[model samples]
Target: MTDVRILGTGAYVPERVVSNDEVAAAAGVDDAWITAKTGIRERRWAAGDQATSDLAAAAGRAALRSAGLTAEDLSVIVVATSTPDRPQPPTAAYVQQRLGATGAAAFDVNAVCSGTVFALSAAEGVLGRTGGHALVIGADVYSRILNRADRRTVILFGDGAGAVVLGASGGQGPRVRHVALHSFGDLSGLIEVPAGGSRMPVDETVLDEGLQYFTMDGRGVRDFVGDHLPRLVKGFLHDCGVTPDDIAHFVPHQANGVMLDSVFAGLDLPRATMHRTLTHYGNTGAASLPITLDSAARAGAFTPGDLILMAGFGGGMAAGFALVEW
Candidate 1:
């Protein structure tokens, strides 16, 4: 059996920095309240001309460069995003065009915040079958889908992108030891964009009610993660033949600081192993894990042979864990 490994990682955030004060004003809240509630100081917003694909391309190029490969060497491009250039063509098509990654199979995954993990699963499968590199990019232009006036939702999101290059192993970065994914379709209503899909087509009615904007049941999501995350992490570690303290790094979805604190409170985890970027990026949805991972890597936090665990939770209400042997 071919062993799939992540060769390199990269990330990108738009240059437009939106401070908590700025967003707070629009949401009719104080900057301190936003920080206290979400532990987010600031986040990046994609420019009007920027789309999910553009962010994906920048991340992909950097990832390929890190891996010493190019777009032409890729066998597949799997993009995980809820925001796209348009609803017609898959976002990966535009990413491919921007990266000049011709002839690679391209598509998008929409597991919401669990998207990148889902995309990684797809890329791992492709690499396993074809023995070539696959670029898995998780990029989202969430600011475009949000209601700026809704403090409950707008305070928790930002736009960003992250990518990883996965291929058949040659004794490189991290070997993909295991990946487990779960979804609670019944909880899908806990987080969603209520309209613009085939079921709720975009119309004056939808627009009038702001149905096109993103919405989330914050308390409900918190309850779900609190109940499930610890168990999920423990299970993943157990299956990987280790304990909570075994992994050197734990990269979880940057959903929110308070939510993360609640989830980890119940787990028997080593306090120092967790890595987070949410204080700066807010909840970047699908891009959270990879972006955090890349940040840690660039900071010289990872060492060869270290165990790295990535866990994500969000809409579908999906959750997944990927154990990496770094």
Candidate 2:
């Protein structure tokens, strides 16, 4: 079987920085309270004119540049997003146009926060068979869907995009070894946007009820992660024929710093240095994992033969795990 590996990675966050103080005031909390709870000092918010595709395109360009490739060389473009530019067209279509990736088949995947891993899995499979490059992007504009006054959801999210270029393994960069995805529809109610879908169309009543805004049962999500994440990580490692100690780096969804601390402790991966960008970026939904991955790569963190494990868990009550040999 031909191997598929990441040729390059890139990330982009909006210019406008929204400080904890800003969100705290809107959410009726103090900066100290926000910091103590989320460990998020600030996060970026998209400008008035920027949409999810714009961020995705910028990141894709950077990734293409990193790979020394061009958009014309791409055969596939997959964008994983929950907050798209519009409900009609897939965000990847816009991204494809922006990047001039006319040769690529463009589409979108809505796995919520676990989206990057899912997109990577899809892109890798496509490239493995087609023998060409694919651009996988995870982007979200949570600010557009958020209720500024809702402390439960608003303060925990930021807008950003991250991307990776994957191609036939050339003994350079990280080669993808294994990928696993799991979804729990039974727990889907734990996090949601109550309206705007067919089940509950956006009417005046829905707007009055603030049903369009993002909402979550924080405690329930915490419990779900506590119960499932560690076991999933262990099982995935076993399936990949690797032990926890073999992992040199672990990048997880930047959901909540407090929750991540708890999950990290339970995983028992002593040798793995957990990489986190949440302190500065907060929870970037689908963009979290890849954004952090790009940051680490740019910082010269990975070495040859190092095993990197990435795990993403979020709103679909879904989880995705991928193992990459660096």
Candidate 3:
């Protein structure tokens, strides 16, 4: 079996910074209240001209540059996103065109926030057989779909993209040791964009009721994470033939700081240093995990022999984990 490893990572968040005061004003809450609950001080929102594809492409370019490869070197391009440029053609098509990755097979994966790891697993599978590099990007423009008045979600999301280049092992960087993906279809209702889908096509009625905006049962989501995350993490580590103490770095979805603190405590990874970018980036859906990973990588946080665990969980009521040997 061919070994697939991450060659490079890159991330891009919009230049426009939306402060807690701004989000608080729009959501009818105070900055302190918002910070106390979510531990987010600010987030980036896309400019009017920017879309998810644009962010994805920029990050893809950066990743390619980091890997010392060009778009022409790509064998596959996978974009994991829910807030795509459109519903018809997959967003990866736009990304491929923008990056000029003409030779690469492109597609999109919609596992909601777990999309990053899902896409990573998919890309790794393809690369294992094809013997070339793959570009995996997780991007979202949640600001476009958010309801400013809905405090439950508006304050928790931002716009950004993160990407990685994967290829055959080169005796450097991080090798993907194992990956696990799980879905809880029974709890799908906990988070969603209720309209603009086949079942509930957007129309005047939908707009009037604000059904096109993102919505979530905040309490239900918290409960779901609390109940499942620790168990999943434990099982994933066990299957990977490691223990919590074996992990040196932990990068997880930038969902909520308070919630992450609780989850981190329950996981019992005493020796692991938890990495977070959500204090300024907010929860960027599928983009969170990779974005955080890129930040840590750029900061020289990991050593060659270190173990890094990346976990992503979100709507679809899904979760994905990847064990990386750094």
Candidate 4:
């Protein structure tokens, strides 16, 4: 069997930074309180003109460049995003065209915050079977789906894109050694964007009720993480026959400081082993994990044989953890 390796990684966040005070000014809160609670100072917001596909394309080009390849080298383009450019026609097709990708199969995956991992699984499956390279991008302009006046959800999300090019390899490759994926649909309502879908529309009622914006049950989400994440992490590691000490790094989804802290404590993970991006970009939803991986790789944070744990939890009340051997 061929080993699948992540050849390159890259990311892009919009230029606009929304500060905590700015968000507070739009809602019922203060900067000090927001900062103390979430450890977030500011987050990037895409311009009104920017769309998720644009960011994904930019990140894709960079990832291809990093891999020392061109768009023509890939056999597939998989985009993992919740904030797509449209509700129809997968964003991957748009991304494929923008990259001038010829004859590549393109599609989208919606696993919310765990999107990149889901997309990665698809890419790995392709590589494992057909022996070809694949481009995977996770991008979201969550600001487009937020109620500017709702601090609870608005302050916790941002816009960004991350990409990775994976290819078939020999025995010496970046292997996804183990994984655990679980979802509890009953708690789905705890975190979701309630309107603007086929179930709801841009009607006067929705507009008046603020239904177009993302609405979340923050306290419910917190409780879920506090109760579930540790057990999940422990189960994943134990199933993989690995110990906490064996991990060189822990990269969780960049949701917020509170969720991250809870997961960290529950897992009894050493603070030093955790990698964080929430401080810089808040939560980019599906884009968070891959962006962090890209950033850390560029910073020389991983050695050739290091073990890295990639995990994420979000809107499906879904969660997944994967162990990667670098």
Candidate 5:
């Protein structure tokens, strides 16, 4: 089997930086309250005209550059995002057009925050079978869907994008060892955007009720993670024929600062092994994992012959894990 190798990585954040104090004042909370809950001091918001595709294309270009490849080299483009430029066309199509990736098969994947993991798994298989390169991007503009007055969802999300180029391994760089992805749709109601889909389309009534905005049962999500995340990690590592002691690095989703701490406290892995950026970036949905991964990689965190464990969980009640050898 031709294992998928990550050739290069890139991440992009919008220029407009938003501080916790700014959001706290709007949400009728204190800065300390927001920080203590999410461990996020600040996050970035996209510009008025900026959209998810713009962010994805920017990160895609950078990843291609890092890989020493051009847009023409990409055989496919997979974008994972819940906030698309428009509902009619898949977001990846806009990204493909922006990148001028003429021949690439482009599409969108919406597993919410677990989108990157889902898209990566698909990209890996596609690249492996096709014997060509694929660009996998996780981008989200949660700012667009957030109800600014709803502190629960508003303070917890930011906008960003990250990208990676996947191709056949030539006996160098990091190679994907095992990828485990699972979804439990029964718990999907815990997190959702209530309207604007097939079951509930947009209308004056929906807008007045604010059904189009993001909504999350924060405590329910916390309880769900506490119940499932540790077991998922343990089961994935066991299936991959490894243990916590064997992992050189762990890059889980940058969900929230305090939430991550709570989640990690129960896990068997060492604390320092986890890479986190939630303090500064908050929860960037699908972009969280890749952004954290790229930042750590660019910072020279991964070394040769190191086993890296990556995990992500999100809105489909979806979860994914990948074991990589660097």
Candidate 6:
């Protein structure tokens, strides 16, 4: 049986770091209050001219370099992002072109913060069927659509990109074991950008209403995390024929520190068992999970034969989980 091993991983964050103080200055909030609430001290934001595709391309190039392969060797590209260069180009094609990749099918995916895991599952399935190598990237420039005047949303987002190269390998290499994805569109209103999609195209009214900005029912998000994450993790582990004890580490979407802490407390798991990156990255939306995983891997956090549980929950009321061996 062919296995899809992560050959290499890479991430790119813009050089500019936006500190809590800077955010507070812009938003009329205090640094202490923000830190105590979200555990975010700083985050990276792209230069004004940079777009999501630029970040994705940079990460993709690094991933290919780390794998000792060129873009030509890639058989597919899947870019997970809510913010694309244009509403139509899919963004993946631009990354593919930037990398000089040819003949590799490419497209975009949207599941908000859960986009990476959902895209990863899709890549694994594609590899399972075709036995081909795939490049999965999560990149977002959330600042573009943010309501700068609204500190609640602007302060919570940043820009970055992370990529992983998944290649078909012999049975000895690590592979995806079990994956699950679910969404409750009924609760989609919990978080959204009201004006961008077909439901409400950008117009004078949208501009007047600030509809393109990120909006969320913070209480709804809090409630969902407090009630849903623990159950999802457990259900995923059960379906994968594993126990919480069997998991070497839990890598979840780095939405907020408070949410993650709550999940740990609810699961009765030691805080040390969960890998986190929200403190430095804030929330990169779809890029959060993959970026955390990449950072952890680079820090030598995993060992051979270790089971890792990955989960994410976000807009679209989306949630997903997967179990894999490192």
lDDT of each: 0.89, 0.93, 0.94, 0.86, 0.90, 0.85
Q: Is candidate 3 or candidate 4 better by TM-score?
A: 3
lDDT string for model 6 (77-195, tens) is 99999898998889999998998889688999999999988888888878877776889999999878877767777778889999888887645545677779999888999999888
Error of 4 at 251 (Å): 0.5
Q: Which is better, 1 or 4, measured by TM-score?
A: 1
Give per-model TM-scores: 0.98, 0.98, 0.99, 0.95, 0.98, 0.96
Q: Give the per-residue lDDT digits (tens) of candidate 1, residues 171-264.
A: 7668888899999999999999999889999999999999999999988998899888888888878888988777777788999888777766
What TM-score number comes out for model 2?
0.98
Model 6 whole-model lDDT (C-alpha atoms): 0.85
lDDT of candidate 2 over 97-197, digit per residue (tens):
99988999999999999999999888877887888999999999999989999899888999999999999755677898999999999999999988988
lDDT accuracy of residue 32 in candidate 2: 93
Q: If candidate 3 were superposed on the true structure by all CA atoms, what would the RMSD be?
A: 0.8
Candidate 2: the clashing residue pairs are: none
Question: How do all the candidates rank in terms of lDDT, highest first?
Answer: 3, 2, 5, 1, 4, 6
Q: CA lDDT of 146 in candidate 1? A: 89
Model 4 CA RMSD to the hidden true structure, in angstroms: 1.6
TM-score of 3: 0.99
Candidate 5 per-residue C-alpha lDDT over 159-256 given as tens digits, one digit per residue, 9 for 90 to 100: 99999998875556688888999998999999999999999999999999999999999988888889999999999989999878888888988888
Superior by TM-score: candidate 3 or candidate 5: 3
Superposed model 4: Cα runs more than 4 Å off? 171-173, 270-272
Better of 5 and 6 by lDDT: 5
Model 4: pairs clashing at backbone N, Cα or C within 3 Å? none
